[model samples]
Target: MSARIQEPRSGGEPRRGETLIQQRNRKIILCAALDEFSAHGFHGASIANIARAAGLSKANLLYYFSRKEELYRALLTSLIDTWGVPLTSLDPDGDPREELLSYVRRKLQQTRTMPRESRLLANEILQGGPHLEGETLESLRRIVQSKTDLIRSWSAAGRIPHVDAPHLLISIWALTQNYADYDSQIRRLLGEEADISDTPQTFLETLYGSLLAS
Candidate 1:
C-alpha cells in the first residue's frame, strides 16, 4: 500500500488534511514579516531575510504569500485592525470626560504595548503613505470624520470646551503616541526613569480639566 500525498487548501476551501504545522508556519511567517517590515520599511525589507527570520525557505514563504508586497499588505492590514480599536471606542452617548479619558488611556496603553506597530505606521506615513491610498485612505477618513462629529457634539452640548474637533483629535494622538514613536529622543531628554504610562492619567487629568473647565 502506498501513502497518499495531501494538497494544501486555497481560495476559502480546506484541503482534506491541513496539519497544525501549516497553521503554525503561517503565523510564524506573519510575525517575522511584521518585524522585518517595521524595521526596514517595505522598500528595504527582503523576502530572503524574512524567510530566514521565519525559519522557512524562500520557496516555502512564497507558498503562503505570492509576493513580498502581498506579505507587507497583510502585515499592514493586521496593524490597522489592531490600531483602530481605541479610535472606534470614542462614544457619543458616554460622558465626555470619561470618554476622552478612556481614549487617552487606551492610546497610551497601545503606545506601550505596540510601539513597533506605531513605528511601522510612522514609517509608512513618512514614506508618503504609499500603501494607504484609495479605499484605505477613504475608510480612515470616514472614521476620523465620525469621531470629529462626536467631539463637535460634545462641545455644542457644553460637555467640553470649544476646540477644533479634528485638531483636538490630532493633538491627543500626537501627545500620547509621541513617547513611543519618538522613544529615542524621549529617552535622551527625560532619561530612563521617565515612564509614559505612569504620567498619562495625571497629565490627561490636568490637561482635560484645564481645556474643558467652564
Candidate 2:
C-alpha cells in the first residue's frame, strides 16, 4: 500500500475553512486502504501496509482512523453507499426490459470503476459476512427485500416473465460481477481485449428479450 496524509478535522465535522489538500489526502488514504484490504482481506491487511500504500506514516494514518476495523468499516460503508445506486435506480414506472437493462449497465459500470471494492465485498461474503453483523446485516437484508419486492411487482403486473425474483436479481449480480470478480479466468478464456462491459448490453438485451417477450 502507498502512504497518504489526511487533513485533520476540527470539532468532529467539516468547517468552512477546510482546504482541498485535506480532502485529497483523505481520499488518497481511503483509496489506498481499499486496495490493500481488497488484496489482503481484513485479518491479512496491516496499518503499516495501508499507511505505506497511502504515502502516510502509521501515526498519521492512526490520527485519521483510530483502528483497522474502523477503517475497514468506513470502506465498507462507502461501498454500500455506491453499490446501492443501481438498485435505487429501478423505476417502478419504467419499461421492465429497459429498467433491467439499465440496472445491468449500472452494475457493469461499477465493475469497471470499483473492481477493488467489489472484490472486497466478495471477500467479506466468502468469509460468511463476518463484518456485516447486527444492524449492518439487517440493513442489507431490508434493501435486498425491497428490491426483491420490486421484481415481484413487475412479474405480477405481467411486465416480466414469472421467475424467482430473488434468484433473478442474484443471477444478474452473478453474471455482471463475474467479469470483475473473476477477471483472471475471463482474461484467459476470452483474451485481454474482450471487454465484459461491451458484451453485457447486447447479451442482456437478448437474454431479457427471450425471457420476457410474450
Candidate 3:
C-alpha cells in the first residue's frame, strides 16, 4: 500500500511545516486586508491598517505581501474570483430565462454575503480604477465581452428578446450591486428594519420575471 499525504486546504489549519504556516498567515492577512480595503478606499487604506487588523506587526504582513499595491492587487484578484462566480454560471445550454434568473438570484445572495467586496470594487471604479486598469481591466473586459456575445447569440436565435445584450447585462450588474454598495441608504430608508437583502432579491425576481418574459 502507498501512503498518501493531504495538501492543505484553504481556511483549514496549517500542517507542521513552514510553507503551511506561511499559507495560513497569508490567508489571515488577506481576510483582514479585505475588510480594511473595503471600509477605506485604496489610497485611504494602508499597510499599517491591514497589519493591525490582521493582528500582526507591519513587518509580518510585509513578509507575505511585499508592498501595499501588491496586497491590494491580491485582494482585487480574490474579489474577482468571488464576484465572477455567479455570472460564470450562465450556461448557453440551459433555458435562457431560467439561467439568467439563476445568475441574478445568486448575485443577490453574494451582495448579502460579500457586501464589503462589492463596495470595495465600486470604490475602486469610482476612483477611475487605477489598479483595475491594464491587465486587470482587460481580463474583466474579456469576460464581459464573451458573456455579452453569448447573450447576443441567444437573442439572435430568438431564445430571448432582441434587447441589447450588453445593456441588459449592465442593468443586471448595476441593479444587483446597488443593494450592496448603497446598503446604508437602503437600510435607513427602510427605517427600523433588519438587514434583509431578500426584499430586493424578491423584487428583482418579479421585475426581471416580467422584463424577460418570452
Candidate 1, residues 116-212: lDDT per residue as tens digits? 7787788898899888755545676788889999889888988888979988888888888787789989878889777767876688768966786
lDDT of 2 by residue, 34-152 (tens): 78888888888899998998788999878767899878877776666567778878888898877877887888788877788888888888888777765545666788898889889
The candidates, ranked best first by lDDT, are: 3, 1, 2
Q: Over the stretch 66-103, how does candidate 3's per-residue lDDT look in tens digits?
A: 78888787677667656776777889899988888898
As a whole number from 0 to 100, the lDDT of residue 120 in candidate 3 is 87
lDDT of each: 0.76, 0.75, 0.77
- Tell me the lDDT of candidate 1: 0.76
Better of 1 and 3 by lDDT: 3
Looking at model 2, which ten-residue stretch has the lowest summed lDDT?
A: 4-13
lDDT of 2: 0.75
Q: Between prediction 2 and prediction 3, which has the larger lDDT?
A: 3
For model 2 the local lDDT of residue 176 reads 76
TM-score of each: 0.86, 0.85, 0.87
Model 1, clash count? Answer: 0
Candidate 2: Cα lDDT at 144: 82
Among these predictions, the greatest lDDT belongs to 3
Candidate 1 Cα misplacement greater than 4 A, ranges: 1-18, 134-136
Worst 10 residues of 1 by lDDT: 1-10
What does each candidate score in C-alpha RMSD?
6.9, 4.0, 6.3
